[model samples]
Target: METTRYSVPFSPLQERIAREAPQLSAALNHLLQAMGASDFEKYINSLSALKKVDDHLLLITKKEMYRSVLTGRFLPVIKECFAVKFVRIVSQ
Candidate 1:
């Protein structure tokens, strides 16, 4: 007997997310390096840019601790780097 396989297609939003994730990571890495915070680059792998709204950017992190660190230490730098008025960091 032969088995058949079916492929699932990604929606436009899914495609946009898939495309944006790596770009977000790269952008963060570059920003961190440029700011001489290369030590923080490792954390970039755990972050994902969910979406943007008005002047704000929504970011998600894999750990709750990262949320605090990012918000407290890096929020201002991130806003400057992305030219965003606000940033919301959420943990998974």
Candidate 2:
């Protein structure tokens, strides 16, 4: 008997995210470095761009503390960097 292997394809949202994640990550790293926020730079790896709505980008972090810090302090900078009118950070 021969067994067949199945592969799962990425959904449209996943595909779009996969394509844009690298650029976002790079931009975030650059911004962090430019702002001299080396202490916060490591947290970049913990963030993920979940979705893009009209003029808004949804971001998720592993912890509520990260979400709070990002929303309170970095939201404006992140919005400017991503050229978005609004950014929402959520903890998962």
Candidate 3:
């Protein structure tokens, strides 16, 4: 008899974030609250993924358009939530 094998799809960055910084959800919630409106919150939540690396955070996305828009519009706000060196975005 032959058996088929299946693999689980997992994201290392996300896993690391969950394991290393469980408080990230509260930080993200605070960031969202600072955005001050639902639309902005929705847009940010839809566009990127954030991972805490050492003392910094990495924001990544698959779309350059979204990355560009986010980097242009909310980079300052993100920096305010973290140190300037702690926040960054990259296309994945």
Model 1 C-alpha lDDT versus the unseen true structure:
0.64
Query: What are the per-model numbers of colliding residue pairs?
Result: 0, 0, 0
lDDT of 3 by residue, 1-92 (tens): 99999986544432444576676756665667777666344455554467666667777777777678777887778777654466677877
Q: Pick the candidate with the highest TM-score.
A: 3
- Candidate 3 ranges beyond 4 A from true positions: 1-20, 36-42
Ranking according to lDDT, highest score first: 3, 1, 2
Better of 2 and 3 by TM-score: 3
25: Cα error in model 2, Å? 5.2
Q: Estimate each model's TM-score.
A: 0.60, 0.60, 0.61
Which residues of candidate 1, in runs, are more than 4 Å off? Answer: 1-18, 21-30, 35-38
Best by lDDT: 3
lDDT of each: 0.64, 0.63, 0.65
lDDT of 1 by residue, 1-92 (tens): 99999986533322444566555545454556755644354444445435666678887777888888878777888777666898889998
Q: Output the better candidate (1/3) by TM-score.
A: 3
